[model samples]
Target: MMRTPAPRLRTYLSGYVLSLVLTVAAYLLVTHPSYSTSLIVGLISALAVVQFLVQLVFFLHISAERKPRWKLMVFIFMVGIVLIIVVGSIWIMNNLNYRMTPQQINTYLNNQGGGF
Candidate 1:
């Protein structure tokens, strides 16, 4: 009986190492910047997306042969939806809080005062 050769372990190891490096780099970018919060946040977000793609293609081996493509696709779609929802909620809430009319502000403050 012929034995099949084992898959290359080094490839997987390298991919893991790359992913770790990217994660650390992203973290550093987010934490080290003291003034440019917006720039840091954008860089971190971009890095996260790149790291996720790397993990999916290299670590997870998400390919046609996997046959569970739909599962991965669905997960990605759900993540996208959640991200949009969260970001949109934050933006809308911020706008509403800061841009409210005097009447709206008075009503909100009154409600809070009543609770207190």
Candidate 2:
């Protein structure tokens, strides 16, 4: 049986430091609130993507694969599933909001003889 080489300590340390920095930066951005809401959200999202990449490379060691490509394929499939869930949730919420306005809710409740 072939033994795989262990990852160096520096990789983990770097990942930890980068993750910490990104978390602190995101916290500071939210707490300080110097920029516009959209800009802040965009910045924090960018930082989150960077942090994810750092975790993938340093912690998950996805780039260090030797033979099988299944891990990478699985990761991609997981991301797709997550995207589908998120988008579907958002779409469902938006549709519900559009369909159930305040007036509509009152009418619905009144029809059921339980309205305010």
* Overall lDDT per candidate, in order of appearance: 0.75, 0.92
The best candidate by lDDT is 2
The residue-by-residue lDDT of candidate 1 on 36-88, one tens digit each, is 88888888888888888877766665542245357678877999999899999
Off by over 4 Å in 2: 1-4, 109-116
lDDT of candidate 2 over 81-107, digit per residue (tens):
999999999999999998898998999
Question: How high a TM-score does candidate 2 get?
Answer: 0.83
How close is every model to the real structure, measured as TM-score? 0.64, 0.83
Lowest summed lDDT window (length 10), candidate 1: 1-10
- Give the C-alpha miss distance for residue 79 in model 1, angstroms: 3.0
Q: Which clashing pairs does model 1 show?
A: none
Error of 1 at 114 (Å): 3.4
Note the residue pairs that clash in candidate 2: none
lDDT measured at residue 87 in model 1 versus the true structure, 0 to 100: 95
Which 10-residue span in candidate 2 carries the lowest summed lDDT?
1-10
